[model samples]
Target: MRFIIQRDHLVQSVQDVMKAVTSRTTIPILTGIKIVATEEGVTLTGSDSDISIESFIPKEEDDKEIVEIKQPGAIVLQARFFSEMVKKLPSDFVEIEVQNHLQTVIRSGNSEFDLIGLDAEEYPQLPQIEEENVFRIPTDLLKAMIRQTSFAVSTSETRPILTGVNWKVENNELYCIATDSHRLALRKAKIEMETPANYNVVIPGKSLNELSKILADNNEQIEIVITENQVLFKAKHLLFFSRLLEGNYPDTSRLIPNESKTEIVLHTKEFLHAIDRASLLAREGKNNVVKFSTIGDGVLEISSNTPEVGKVVEELKGVSVDGEELKISFSAKYMMDALKAIEGNEIKILFTGAMRPFVIYPINDDSTLQLILPVRTY
Candidate 1:
């Protein structure tokens, strides 16, 4: 493949594709990034068996020539070296050419380098998705859904299914849920559908995190396609595919309580900051536990104690407090994570009891909810 392309466009596309490339794959070729040059444009792809990302750059966009193709062909280059070389190139444009016997040449301004290239034919074919069961969502909304839930997924491999986020669609609403047994996050959005979509799939949290970073905050609609074991997210000129997690996710409906013994409405940032500060002491504790107690008169006290690190206490005045007085202990880290996921100024917390799980949500919105299991204090 021979092409001269703008360095900026090429750098961005290569970086996006590299998100899927990993050096630890069983297949050696999977470590390289595949580049193909055609009359239309240049395509770059990367895969690590579980996820594949493809980025395309057209020859001309907005009446400007972004790529000039001298020869149409394909090659696989070492991702580590190629990515670094492309970034450090001291020119606005770069020329890449594939010579005889898998030899590759890269040139920019006053610098040039020759590198070994692998046969593109060796790269595995991406799963063929027919785009049959397809749905569309706003790019920003999709990113938010991922951000609000992906963090709560378990990192352990013991329960492989728990390492993925559950996506369920019913009655034109898509609900994203993630939990690590100790804490859970849930977000729901109403989506207009052409036909009823009844897909319940689990996607790895790592895949969703990469997708969220690649997606932009725009009004464009992102097309999603789901097959038996794969899910595709298509946005503009980018395509992302991830393998679906096998096995059914545990039903979490029974975990949310219908009644609460205590309820408090407070500023999100204020509560998060208090927990963050108190966590300094909690770091010295075994469980990193922080305690919250209702002191009446719309006041909530957050405190943490460590025999070695000293004790820290902070009181927060909320908008309102109701129900019975309660004191609960929970993971300081978990509480901070949930608060960061909740994108609102005001937060409403519902506590069932001192020892029971509690649910938190935005006071003005019911679309997202977070639940945390209290830590036992002995």
Candidate 2:
């Protein structure tokens, strides 16, 4: 395989595909990136079984030549070294040639490096996903949905299912939810579709996080195709594929309460800052617990106490608290996370009781909701 490509274009594609390459893979070939040069353009693929990312650079775009292919073939080069070499190449273009026995040479202006390449045939083939069930979503909207929920996924592998975010689509509506048993985040959006079909899929939170990072703030529509065990995300010139978890995600609809005893409307930033300050002291405590009390005269008291570090008390102004006045204790970290995920300036928090899980939502928006389980402070 031989190709001369623009340095900047190759660097961008390499970085995108590198997200799927894992250094800890048991297979030696998995540590390298597969490059294929064809008549159309050059394609770079990186995969680690669970996730695969492919980026394409056309030979000519907008009447400008981006890649010139001398021979049509494929080669796999070590990702770490190749990525660094491409980034530091001191020229506007890079020339790559693969000779007999998979020997590869990368050359720029005044420097050249030889890397032992593997046969691309050894790389595992990406699972083919038939476009039978396909849907489209705006890139920015998809990124928002991922951001609002992926953080709440459990990091522990004990319950493998909980490590992924649950994505459900029904009747032209998309819902994304994630929870670690202590806190839950849910986001809903209306989607445009022709035929309506219900889909319940669990995608690894880590994969979604990577996808969100790769999705730029553009108005382009992304095509999503789901098969029995794989999901494919197709952006302009990039394709991202992830393996679906095997177990059924637990039903979380019943976990959200229907009633509330106390409701408070407060500024998101105010509450977030209060929690941030309270966490300073709570961090010294056992479970990082902070107490929130609803007092008279539109005042919310934020306090935390540690046997060795004493206590802290702060009052946040500008909130309307109704129903029975209550005091509740919860993880400061959880509250801060929920507050950061909210998109509005004003937020409403609904508390069923002192011990029940409380829900947080934007004042006038029902499309997004966050729930946090209270922690007991003796």
Candidate 3:
């Protein structure tokens, strides 16, 4: 196998594929990246059983040559060394040649490295998804959905299902919901489906995090294909596959309050800033809890007190404060996370009661919501 590739393109592809490569895989070949050079272009694949990423660099993009293949073949090389070597190569171009017995030579301006390569035949084959269902979403929308919801996935392993984001598609809309029992974030966006799809699948949070990073912020549409046990996301020239979590995700509908006992409309940044400041003191406290209270007419006061440290008092003038006045305490970290996810000038906070869970969402929009369970302060 012999090919000459632009270093810039090769480096970017290597970084994307390396996200799925793990050093501790039980299969020895999984630690290596498989490179296949063909007449059309070059394909780079890396996997660790749970997730796989394939990056393709075309021989010519828009009439510009990115790669030139002398002999079409495939080889698997150690990802750790090969990926680093490409980045540090002395020139803007890279040449790779595989000889008999899997001897590989990588050369650049004034630098030459010889690596022992493995037969690409030993690498596990990427799953060929028949794709009974496929949906298309704008790249920007997909990245926003991931950022808005994936953060709330449970980090605990006690309930393995909560560690994944619940993806649901129905009525031409896609909804992603994630919760760690204490806080939940849900984002919804309209999608066009080739056929109507009603799939409720739980995808591991880790996988979505990697996918979000791989995607660029552009108008390009990403195609999502779902089978029974796996999901594939095709973005630009890359293909990402992840194994779906096995268990059923818990129904989160009942958790969101139907109505609110107290509601407040406040500027998003102002509220976020108050909570961020109040959190400093809360961080020194036992539970990192901050208190919120509605005062006469229009004042909202946020306070945090720690016996060992000090107290913080920050007030914000709300755009409008209505409903029954109430006081509630919740994790400062959770509030900040929720506030960051909401996009807009103003935000609405709905509280069921002092003890019941409350929801934070952008005003005048029903698409995104963040729910938080208040912490008891005794």
TM-score of each: 0.98, 0.98, 0.99
Supply the global lDDT for candidate 2. Answer: 0.92
Per-residue CA lDDT of model 2 for 1-378, tens digit only, reads: 899999999999999999999999999999999999999999999999999999999999999999999999999999999999999999999999999999999999999999999989989998887777678899999998998999999999999999999999998889999999999999999876656778999999999998888777997899888777889999988999999998999999998999999989999998898899889988977689999997788888999988788888999875688888889999999999899999999999999988899999998999999999999773
Candidate 1: tens digits of C-alpha lDDT, residues 267-295: 89988999999999999878899988988
Every model's Cα RMSD, please?
Answer: 1.1, 1.0, 0.9
Query: Candidate 1: misplaced stretches above 4 Å?
Result: none
Model 1 Cα displacement at 216 (Å)? 1.9
Query: Lowest-lDDT window of 10 residues in candidate 1?
Result: 190-199
Cα lDDT, model 2, residue 192: 68
Residue 77 in model 1: lDDT: 96
Candidate 3 regions with alpha-carbon error over 4 angstroms:
none
Write one digit per residue (lDDT tens) for candidate 3, span 66-114: 9999999999999999999999999999999999999999999999999
Location of the lowest summed lDDT over 10 successive residues in candidate 3: 279-288
